[model samples]
Target: MSELVVAEGVALELRPARLGSRAAALVLDLILMAVLYEICYQLLRALAGSGASDDTVSALDIVSILLVAVGYPLVCETISSGRSVGKLAAGLRVVRLDGGPERFRHAMVRAMALLFADIGLPITLITGLPVLILLGLPGAVAVACSRQGRRLGDLLAGTIVVRERSETSPGTMPMPPHPELARWATTARVEDVPPGLILAARQLLSRVFELDRTAAAELTEELARQVAEHVSPQPPRGVAPYQYLVAVTAERYRREIGVNDPSNGTYRAYRGPRPGFPGTRTGARSAS
Candidate 1:
């Protein structure tokens, strides 16, 4: 079976996030909620007075609680840029399904859904059978099952929650090299190049490489065509396909090489030793 892979700095085997992270996020949220509830309850009681009618007092209580439920997520998301206070504290953020930044609408939907999932069912249980509480269970389960730990609300809103990692921890691995010929080239031995050069090249390749060979070739070909069309005069003679590939790859490592020519096509130049040369160590040459 074709495996479902989640790439990190390196291609690691996919695994579900630990439930502890979710629990921590929920616990933090509950603490904030308790504080909000206490403040709101006190304010409502003071406004209504002890002599207020039972109906009036009950209405005030419900309104105060509902307001807390509805507004908490919205306020948190808005202020923290798509992360609730709890999620922020827990080092997590909600992102669009496409791996882009989260938008306000998604935040709203997710916040509202969270309130319903966390509060609505309990309220229904107080007034109805125990089984009624199960209505919200699915929402929680959906979150647990999602790749990004997204709840039903997140799915509905086209969002996902991702944990934050330090800069040292590779955030997202660049797309893998194309599975066919491109993969062969990318998987080439690192020993052939300087350590810094190899690392830089890998970083560039990560961003542009794809796991599918056909797609990689198509992308490279299109890029080559564009370069051929755009440049006023063609590249100097003796720039074979391999040389061009080196040039393109080197260009992607812009910081190291300090050259930017989109017309050079997707490939960048290599600052490392020329290809086909023997290295100091046998293993190094073997790797190349």
Candidate 2:
């Protein structure tokens, strides 16, 4: 499982498609491409007739090859958001490094690479049947050697193939933000929070109940102290650090999804003592 931390520190766990599954998907795509090519070939032959010249025959072959090899993948992946027929059937999807949908440039690079490297279309055209043995060798080798099971195109395009489904679910839900802190959360500046700290906070919250009581308290205090340095307008007096973290995280989620402050049109700047600043309470008290 690869952990991709997107904006505002939301962690998305994606499983990289394995070699066997990828190969199976490729085979399925090739079978479909072959069928499509055969159809185009027969249609072209009918149009050209038995007395067709060499130039006409060559043009027909080029059109068929390009349509099946390059056009198929490019059109499919671009329209389907990184899923060709084969990938969709195999429950796989291509995504950018940040867990976002694959764009046109990414799909185009992969399609061209598939045509040139995986299918070896140009080489096959030149060498006749002998080059068939080497077809797909580059993609297979690259996938096998890549830690993320990515082919050459994936490396160039900054994309990775991941399973469409995830096997693991969040084990526990963190505490909800304190009701008193709701107003503060609506306008908190959480964009500056480091991804590492957010990930740590999420992990801590998930496992907090499982840890030794003394250890959990100590960790909560230490992590809250670090987090406070980045967040402003420390929670009102007596609000626990855990509650503070939950509130900040909620605010971050709200911001990430482009939800603006519903109550008021503008975000008023915070004037209260920011957490961890001089003259402010530690704000790390354990929640009851």
Candidate 3:
């Protein structure tokens, strides 16, 4: 399973396509291309037979071959957002290494290299030296050696083809920004929280806001326990777990922003000595 960490720090699990499925998909696409090529080939011949000039026929043939052989795959993948008929049928899709959808340029680059492997290699083999072996052989070897089955084209394009996987809905908002926590947040330091746990906290906070009252309270408590494992200096006895997470996560956001430019004034920097957080005797900032 391939896991990608998105902007929200949520790790999304994706399934990478294996060799067998890739090969089958390629075969299906090739068959479709062959049918297109044959239709074009026969039409060009029929035109020549119908008293069209030999030069006209020859030119049209070259154009047809180029369009059917090279142009089809390029157009299909780009227009379909990294899916050809074969890829769609095979439940595969192409995406950037960063897990974003591939764009037109990426599709074009991948297709240009694929042209050498799909057409040039076979044509070259018909000759003695197999000149296009440079393209096809290297790409095949790269695919075999790559952990994610990337080929030369995919590497050059900074893309990967993965089996179609379920998508996750991004969180609506993160716990409503906990404005009350901002004062103490300036002094609070979050320790021992894993990134995944942090994401979970964010997700739960967002979801709980939309849940029924009983469900929200129940989920909040359960999620807080999961979050608490990674946090240090637990909240005081009377404080609700959900509220504790709000303060902790809010502090984390402040610190992350403050490191870049403390003068940015994104956080409310209370005057005087730093107040100890919940359960500590240090003078706490008064709520405005």
Q: Which model scores highest in lDDT? A: 2
Which runs in model 1 stand beyond 4 Å of their true positions? Answer: 1-18, 118-136, 166-288
For model 3, what is the error of residue 165's alpha carbon versus the real structure, in angstroms, after optimal superposition?
A: 3.9
Q: How high is the lDDT of residue 225 in model 3?
A: 66
**Ranking of candidates on TM-score, top first:** 2, 1, 3
What's the CA error at residue 110 for candidate 3, in Å? 1.2
TM-score of each: 0.53, 0.57, 0.50
Q: Superposing every Cα of model 3 onto the true structure, what RMSD results?
A: 15.9
**Global fold similarity of model 3 (TM-score):** 0.50
Global lDDT of each model?
A: 0.48, 0.69, 0.60
User: Using TM-score as the measure, which candidate wins?
Assistant: 2
Q: On residues 1-288, what C-alpha lDDT tens digit does candidate 2 reach at each position?
A: 667654334444557888898988888998999999999988998998999998999999988988888888888888877788898889888877655557799988998888787656667777785666877877888988987889988988888888764421222334445455767777666665544455557666665555666665666666666667677766676767767777676566556556546345333343433232122243546322
